[model samples]
Each structure stands twice: as structure tokens, then as C-alpha cells.
Target: MTDEHPHRPRLAPLPEDGWDPSARELLAPIPRDADGRLPHVFTTLVRHPGLFRHFLPFGTHLLRHGRLAGRTRELLILRTARNTRAAYEWGRHVPLARAAGVTDEEIRRVGAGPDAPGWTPADALLLRAADELHREARLSAATWSALAADHDEAQLIEITMLVGQYHMVAFFLNSAGTPLEPGFTTEALPAATGTADDDA
Candidate 1:
């Protein structure tokens, strides 16, 4: 990341020494490398401390308090990452998606898209919802009804918010040129099969 993207980030991340007491307390739980530094996105976002403070609770809710199944949330997040061409987001979520029970093959196929063979009807619809929202900014009636069958009112609301949240996250990650930290999020984000629609 250093050499390949030395100047890619338009905004420099706050160096560790510059972290204040509040910043340190806030970032205490974030993963650190052998060098024990915070994640690139966190350090970078902290450059805008006010925005970071306000965004934390909302992001935390989607990540920790959402009603969707872990695997479901991960799927939406990964799909949203692909849709936005946010490689940083995609790389970060690959392991999380896997840990949440999404298989390696399934992860690969997500890039292939919701229509790719082998997805169960439910899984396909979930990914399709991501695609429809990404491309159209809203879900189709068919997709919505299909999702409604398995998800309750709260889960349904969670579904849209979770996917939309990642879209917002992706926008910042890409625009800010957030670098993937070493020993973390090193997965290669592959381009999906078709670029007439890509983001695999």
C-alpha cells in the first residue's frame, strides 16, 4: 500500500502519536497489526473527528445490532462493496463474510452475481436485492415480496439499512482512497464476470 499508493489517499491518516485520549479510547477495540497501529480507515476518518464521532453509533448499530443473520448481512455488504467498486470494502469484508458462514465458492460466485448458478433461491434474492438497489436505488416488487417471505418487518428494515450503510461506507472508502492495512484485508477483490455489469 505504501509504495503502490503513496499518494493515492487525498487525505492523510492521523498518525498514531497525534491520537488524543478520546481517540485512543474510541479505537481501543479495533484490530491492530504487529506494529500495533489502528486500521487505515479509522486513522483516516479520524482526520474528520466530528464526522467520525457522529457516524460511529450508526455504523455500530448496523454491524452489531442489525436483525439480519450474520451471513445475510455479510452477503449484502460484500455485494454492495462490489457494486460500488470499493475494493477496500470488498477486501475487508471477505473474511467477515466467510466467518459469517459464506463459503469461499459462494464468495467467488457473489462476484458472478445473484443470477449465477448454484445460489439457493433465498440467497439469490438477497443478492439480487443488493444488485437492484445498487443499480436502481430501490428494490423491485418481485424481489421485495420474495424477501418479505422470510424476513419480518424489522428484518426487512434492517436489510435495506444494512445494505445502504455499506454503500455509504464504500463511497467514503473509495473517495478517501482508504488503504488496506498490512496483515489485514489482504484479499484480492476480483472483478465480477460481466462488466456490462461488474463488481465481483
Candidate 2:
């Protein structure tokens, strides 16, 4: 992987002292680390409470309550992380992928892309869907048909939304310079073995 990120934060994560009551209130219920601090994405975004407030429910729903299976959702997320080269987003979702029963080998294959050996037909469709959406914002008919064969309408919709949402998050984290929280420890996106994985 290239590991190329020349961009710096145009607006850094809001520091603790800068958190106003509204920001504090919004961040309070969010899961926090051992230090009782939210993720960089949350703290940085709390700087804009209006957007933060609105983003919470939508993001939480996709991550927690969506119709997509956990492993399925994580595959799409990890693929988005790879396509966008969003390091922070990639780092965060990996453990979630693990918890969802995505094995170490499968995680590596996500970076290699949908065509890598061992992926089932359904799994390939998911990764290809992410790549297509990232490149063109639309799924091909074949991809759509393949996905539809297994997934209901709700799951299909969630698939598009999930990929798009992470693309947006990648934009924010990359542009805002959301740093990995201190003491965070997780393996990075698997390094690229082909053009499909320039970085993650």
C-alpha cells in the first residue's frame, strides 16, 4: 500500500477544553474508550453539533440496526476504506469485522478485492459493488441482480447506503485529519498486492 496521505487537518478534532455544553451533551452517551473519550471522528465532528446531531442516528442505524448481516456490512465497510484510502476508517472497522466472524484471511482478501481467490459469488458481488459505487456512484445491472438474488429490498438499500456513508466518513476523516486515538492498536488494512489496493 502506498500509505500516501499528504493532507493535513483543515479543521482538527476539537480539543477537550473547547467542548461546549451542547457538544458535551451530544458526546456523553456515545461509547468511549478507557480514557472516557470518544473517537477522534466523534470529537472532531462534535465541533459542528448540528451535523453531529443529525449524523448520529443515521450512522448508528447503519452500524447497529441495519438489515445487512454483520459480516456483510463489514466487508462493504472495509472495501470502502480500501477504495478511499481512509486510514482511520479502515483501522476502526477491522475489529468489528473480526467480531462479525470475518477471519484474518478474509480481511486480507478484502484489500485484494472481490476477485481474489476463495470469495464466494455473493461475496464478490459485495466488493465489486463497493468498487463500482466508489468509481461511478452506481451499480451495474449484473451486480444489482446478483445482490438481489440473496438480499431483500431493505438489505439492498442498506448496501448502497452503507458504502456511500463510509465514503462520506472517509472524506471527513481524510479532510479533517482525524487522527487515530492514542493507544489504539489494530492491524492496518492489508497492503496492496494489486491495483485494487493502493492503500487502506
Candidate 3:
């Protein structure tokens, strides 16, 4: 899909030499590209060093310590990215989603949403929960019950927070107009089929 709003970034990425000491410290744990440059998202976010410092720990927890399975978390993030039309987030996570074992077909189907054919029950429930959260800010009774059946309370809570976290990340990426990293492509997945206007 063509970008509807290709606005230039309101906060441009900081040059490497321009990074604050605090920002550099916060970014230390993130892996660098072969060129030793940080990802565009990090570079852009570090323009606000205080926010970047506080945001990284929680994000690291979600990525490294969340109770949700890797594939499940990736699915939640990918769906959230699509729901929010966050091209930068979507592009960055595509390979991570794949490494977590989301198939190419399943990735494409994510754009079609929970009702799309061929999803296992658990996968469908995940997508439905993501859709409901994105559109309505709450899960339907049935979706909540379905999720509760398979996940422990901790996992269930993590799932909800995981989606919310990615939504916040997407909002920031889209609002700040963060560009995709070098060689990144947002076209790997299909265009999102569900709109914000669609009923959850």
C-alpha cells in the first residue's frame, strides 16, 4: 500500500557524534549493524535521551523475558504493526518474526486478520485478541475466555501488555516518521486487510 502521509520526521535522527552520553549508555545493549551504526528507530528515539533511557528496560523485558512464546510475541507485534500502519515497526520485526518461526504464509495471513483461513485455534485467538485490542481497546468476552483457557494468568497478562507495548512503539514510530533501516523492505507482508473502521 502506498503511504498516505509521507511526512518528514518531526524529530530527525541524531548524528553519532551528537548522541548524549545518557543516550549512548542506554543504547549500549542494542546490537549494531555491520557498519556499527544503530538502527534508525534507536537513533531517532535517542534524540530524547530521558525517554529513551526509561523505554529501553521495559522493551528489553518484553523481548528477552516475557512469558509469551517467541512466535506468539512476534505474531502479536506483527499484527499490532499492521493494525497501526507502522511501516518502520513492521519492517524491523519481519525478520525477527520469521526467526521466531512465523511462516511466510502466516505472515501474509496476519494482514488478513483472525478470520482468515488456515490459522490454528490458538493463532486465531491471538489475532482476534490483537484486533479487538487495536480497534476497541479491550477484548471481547469470548476472546478473553479463549485466551484464558490456553494461557496461565501471567502469560495472559504478558500477552495483553505485549500488544500494548508494540502499539505504543508503533505509535511512536509512525508519529515520529522513523525511516526503515538500510536494505529494509516493508512490502514483504501483504497490505493490511482490516481497517480501523472494521468491527472487532
Candidate 4:
């Protein structure tokens, strides 16, 4: 996938300077207070703690426990990751995608835009929804019909929220220099494949 983020020179080691160690501390497994423990980005967002609390539960619902089918949610997330080229979001979700039964072929195809032929009908609709969401900020009637035909009301809402949430996450990760997870690797896609930009 493309890495669209602005480049930054690596900063020197932390903990040497007197800067708070809270950032690295949160990445540890042990839990801490809400303000003390979160993803690195969340910890940085502590400046706006109220927004953190607000998005946390809503983001969790769309991502962790919402009504959307696991694989469908992953497909949407994968599309968002590529659209934004958020390396860190892609790193975190690709494993979740695999666990949700997304194969390497499916993962590579995320960059393939809406018409890639190997996807199931549901998967194609999900991709179309992603495309529409990116280009128009909402799904078109035909795309929504494709989704609503198979998904219930709750699932439809969940999918909308999931798309919005992941868009936010991808923006943050890409803009804030959220590093790709340690030892994370993405599968390579075939060259000259159809892409979201081309479809757009």
C-alpha cells in the first residue's frame, strides 16, 4: 500500500530527556487510569480528554462489538486503511482481518477498488460503500440498497459508524506519524492491478 504520510526524521531516544514517559508507559500491557493508559495517539490526544472518552466507546462499538459481521467490518476497515494509506491502522487491522477469515488474496484486493471479481457480493458492496464514503461522504442509493438487502438496520448503522470511525483513525495515524506496529508486515499485491484511484 502507499505511504502518503509526511516524512519525519526519527527523534532521539526518549526517557533520556525529561519528557514524561507516559507515552511508552501506556503501550505496556498493565492497565492504568483512563488518562494514563491508551494507544499512543490517545495518550497524545489527552489534551482533549473529553473527546477521547466520547470517541472511545463509540469507536469500540463500531470496531469491537457492533452488529456488522466481523469479515464485513474488516473489509471496510481494509479499504479505509488503503484509501488513507495509514500504515499503522493497516498493521493493526490486517491480523484482525485474517482472524475474521479475510485471506491474503482478499487483503491484497483491498487496493483493487470496487470491481475486483473475486469478492463476494457482500464484500463488493462493502467496497462500494467505502468508495462512495470517500468520494461523497455517504453511500449512493444503489450502493446502500446492495448493503441493506443483506444487512439489518442495526448492521447498516454499524457499518456507517465503522466507516466514519476508521476514516478518523486512518487520518490520525497517517498525520500523527503513528508508527507501524513492531514487526508488522503486509502481503505484497500484484503490480498493474486496478486501484481505488483508477475506479474513482
> Top model by TM-score, which number?
3
Residue 93 lDDT (model 2): 88
Mark the regions of model 2 whose C-alpha exceeds 4 Å error after superposition: 1-8, 192-200
Q: In model 3, what is the error at residue 39, expressed in angstroms?
A: 1.2
Per-residue lDDT over 21-78 for candidate 2, one digit per residue giving the tens place of the 0 to 100 score = 9988998889987887778899889888999999999999999999999999999999
Candidate 3: which stretches are off by over 4 Å?
A: 1-3, 186-189
- Distance from true location, Cα of 123 in model 4, Å: 1.0
Q: Positional deviation of 152 in candidate 1, in angstroms?
A: 0.7
Better of 3 and 4 by TM-score: 3
TM-score of each: 0.89, 0.91, 0.92, 0.78
- Compose the digit string of candidate 3's lDDT tens values, residues 1-200: 34564578876777788766787787788998777788888888887777888888899999888899999999998888888888888888888889999998898888888877899999988988888888888888998898999899999888889899999988788778887767676455455466444534
Cα-lDDT of candidate 4:
0.69
The TM-score measured for candidate 4 stands at 0.78
TM-score of 3: 0.92
Positional deviation of residue 61's Cα in model 1 after best superposition, in angstroms: 1.3
Cα lDDT of model 4 by residue, 1-200, tens digit: 46455565132212213334443333343244344433445544433445755666677667668888799999998887777666667776788899999998888888886798788877888888887887779888998888788888988887787888888877766666755434454543234345456677
* lDDT for 149 (candidate 2): 91
lDDT measured at residue 22 in model 2 versus the true structure, 0 to 100: 98
The models' CA-based lDDT, in order, is 0.79, 0.85, 0.83, 0.69
Candidate 2 local Cα displacement, residue 188, angstroms:
1.6
TM-score, structure 1 vs. true: 0.89
Model 1, runs deviating above 4 Å: 1-7, 29-35, 195-200
